[model samples]
Target: MIIAVIGAGYVGLITALCLAKIGKSVICFDMQTDKIESLKNGIAPFLEPGLPELLQEATNSGKVKFTSNINDLKDSSIAFVCVGTPNDPKTGSSDLSYLYSAIESLENVLSQSSTIVIKSTVPIGTGEDIYKKYPKKLSFASCPEFLREGSAIYDFMNPERIIIGTRNDQDKSRIIDIFGYFKDKAEFVHTNVTTAEMIKYAANSFLAMKVGFINEMARLCDSFDANIKDVSLGIGLDSRIGKAFLNPGPGFGGSCFPKDVKALSTTAQNHAKELPIINNILVSNQMHKEYLADFIVKIAQKYNQNNIGILGVTFKANTDDMRDSASLTILPMLKSKGLNAIIYDPAYTNSKPKELDNFNFVNNLQGVLDSTKIIVVLTEWSEFKGLNFNSDAIIIDFRNIYCISDMQKQNIKYYNLGRLNEGAN
Candidate 1:
């Protein structure tokens, strides 16, 4: 089967490479000539574990090709739209301009029997709207992707479920055949386009709510002199509430959770409905970010520590994505209060965020640790564990990366969310 993936971003590149690995000939198209050229040379633009090697292998096999021209999509029987739907700054709704442009470009070269799959996360009814506007010969489906950034390759190869959203039986059959490689490995869900779109939004929003709920619980645990680690384990052991986003941290911030939660709330408001839980999740998450900043400042003041060290600036470990990361908000808040921070991340040693252009970033963890009196573990990177610590340095662990007893045994001042005595000097 010949497949075309639009937009050479994380989703498009991974999808094209994985499809080629599964024996399908794929041509990936992106408007960015530089990104296309980089891919052509077997170099990935972003940091994803196991992606560069996979790209090299696919390129060597000659099963996948990268191009900047829309004309390259002519031979593809199916084209997957993987463009981004970033949140609108003014309205907090998903900006579909990129998706629309991709559709327009695909429409120009679409064959009579070609299927256009919407793999991007979009609002409900978007698929129907596209199908209505496009020619009858072209088919549409809403097959939203659920791959995480760091483990995208593994997720793509071992998806839990494959959703095919189409109205026509012929379209469903065609999509099934396209994904026949995963027929036995994953569950195939056939549904209408709107429901499939709703599933993506609802799934992400629910996970965001879970993170928010646990963070709120962590605050209560702090007040009542309880430990969230124990609380999570006790509740997780129950069959009804399985543990998965229960671990407390600064807050949940990433490419999908924050934007999708806001988009879902906006969608509900557009329909003249109320979503109190979703609204509270957003507010609570914002407050949590501020709370962490204030907590760090309070600790620094208590110990008379002026210099701060930050570990892990990326949203999560194993990926270099800094979109909506907690460090983005927390570090700026601290800087505004005249506190200085030296930051370090394994992936972002060379790159500086535009927002944090003036901030200090060290190339190694030891440099950050040496320059600051207070060490803040912002992102949960595995490399931060078992590191040598200065006895005088105060450690504020947002991700609970270390045990409270261990920190106490070393006689180091350590603080973590949801643990009692964290605020005590």
Candidate 2:
């Protein structure tokens, strides 16, 4: 069957490429001429592992094609709308403009009775609202994506569960057949559209809570002189509290967590209810970033160093996304305190972002090592794992990439997230 994948952004591109991988004849359509041109040349706009290779293979096999013209999607029977639903700044609810716009664009070219699957994360009740508007023109299904940024390809191929939210049995079966390879291993969850939408919001908010809870524990560990890593291990072994999303990092900053958490909270509030726990997740995460900034300032003051070296800037490693990274918050705080930041991220070797236009950007890791004696490890990239530093450097390992034991042997002073034995020989 010829399937049309809408939008070519991060999730859209991943969806289109993975759909092609599953032997579907995919026509991936986007409005941007530049993005379509790049895809035609096998160049993905964003850095995702295994995506470029997959794109090349799929295009070479004549299974997929990218196009700027919407009419290219004329013959497609199934249209998967993978457009973005970013949170609206004013309402803290999702801006459905992109979702609505994608539908309007599809309405122009999609064949009558074509099935439209929403792969984007949207607010609850969106399905019912859409069905009321386009009942005869199309068939609707809510099949939200749960792919992570770095491991998107693997997650798509081996999903833990594939939720197909539709009342129609034929619609469900046909959609399930699109991902037929997953039936052997993945659970096929059947739900109404509203329930499926709630599931996405619930899952993302819960993961965000785990991150906020751990960071809060890490702060308590700081006060009590305890090791959070050991505490994490202790709680994670209970089986109820699995060791996922338990890593203590700067903050939860990606496209999904921050946006979904806020959108869910706003949704609850709209229903005349209060979600204190969900509300506190965002509050706690923001406080965590500010707390880390204050801690770093105190460290810089103790070391008497105005020039601080920043190791990484991306939210996490392996992808070049900086949507809601804590670096965006923490770096500006340091600059406001008159501290000079010398930042180096492997992703930004070509050029730095305009948000960080004021801070000095170094082309290499060695540039950061040479310019400052005080260093702060922000994002834990793979390249920073085995880095060797010499001389008397004071390092604050936020992501805890460096070993405290090894730091002492090298005569470098190091601090990490509540590891009590960081000082001893």
Candidate 3:
């Protein structure tokens, strides 16, 4: 089967590569000429674990191809819309400019009776709107992708469930057949298109709420002199609560959770409905970044130094995406207080970090630590897990990289987001 994936971003690239590995021919369409040129040379625009190898293998095998021309989507049996729907500045709602553009572009070239799948995260009722736009000539379905960064290929290949929402039985059957490429590996759930769209936003918002709830607990624990790790462990052991997304950090900052949560809340308010939990989740995460900034400021004030070292700059480990990263928010707060923060991320390449202002980027770990008075473990990379803490240098381990026992044994003054410090021996 021939599949065309629009927008060679994280979702588009990962989906196209994975589907090609399963013997399907894929054409990845993007508007950026440079990105397409890079892909043709076997270079991925962004750094993702295992994607480079997979993309190279697919290209070598003649299974996958990349092009900037929309004409390349012709003769494709299935078209997947994976373009970005970034958050808007005005209303915090999801901006669908890219999505609308993609549809209009496809409408000009799409073959009659072609199936279009929406893999991008959109608000509820978006599927119905898209279905209305194309009418009977084109088959539309909302097959919202549930893949995470850093592990996107694995998640796509081994999805927990594949949900396809269609209004008609014929459309549903065609959708199921296309997904038959999975060969019973994934559980298929069929529902109305609106429900499928809602699932993506709902799932992302729930995870965001969980992070905010734990961070709030961490704040109260700090005030009462209690250990949050112990409390979280006790609660997480319950089968009902499950321990994922329980670890608190500077805040939840990534492409999906932050944007989707706000979009979902905005959608609810538009209909005169109340979503206090969702609204609070967004506000609480913002405050969490400020709290982390204040924590670092307090440590910097003690030494009377204006320089601070940041260990990791990305949102999470194993991925180099810095979009909406908590460090971006927290760094500005520190700079406003007269602290010039130096950042060191091993994956900092091809992107200019100097343009961010009030911050200096270092390529080496030792260089950042040597020049600054204190170290802030922001992203929780595995390399930061076993650092020597015996030095008198103050450290604020925001992602809980150091255990309380080890920090005390090494006499390291450390503070974490959720866990209380055991104090230096």
Model 3: lowest-lDDT 10 consecutive positions: 349-358
| Segments in model 1 whose C-alpha atoms lie over 4 Å from true places | 135-137
Q: The CA-based lDDT of model 1 is what?
A: 0.89
What residue runs in model 2 are displaced by over 4 Å at the alpha carbon?
135-137, 421-425
lDDT of 1 by residue, 227-337 (tens): 999999899888788888789988888899999999999989999999899877889999999988998889988988878999988888898888888888899899998
- For every model shown, the clashing-pair count is 0, 0, 0
Question: On residues 1-425, what C-alpha lDDT tens digit does candidate 3 reach at each position?
Answer: 68899989999999889888988888999999999999999998887889889989999989999999998887887789999999998987789999989988887788876777888998899877876776545777789999889888989999888989887787788768766878578989889889999988888899999988898898778776687888788889998998887887889998888889889999999999998988888899999988888878877776677888899888898888888888889988988998888888877733445435556887778887788758899887888878774377778888876777777787767777656544222
- Relative to the true structure, how large is the alpha-carbon lDDT of every model? 0.89, 0.88, 0.84
Rank the models by lDDT, top first: 1, 2, 3
**Cα lDDT of model 2 by residue, 129-166, tens digit:** 88788645577888989989888889888899999998
In model 2, where is the ten-residue run with the lowest total lDDT?
A: 416-425
Q: Candidate 3: how many backbone clashes?
A: 0
lDDT of predicted model 2: 0.88
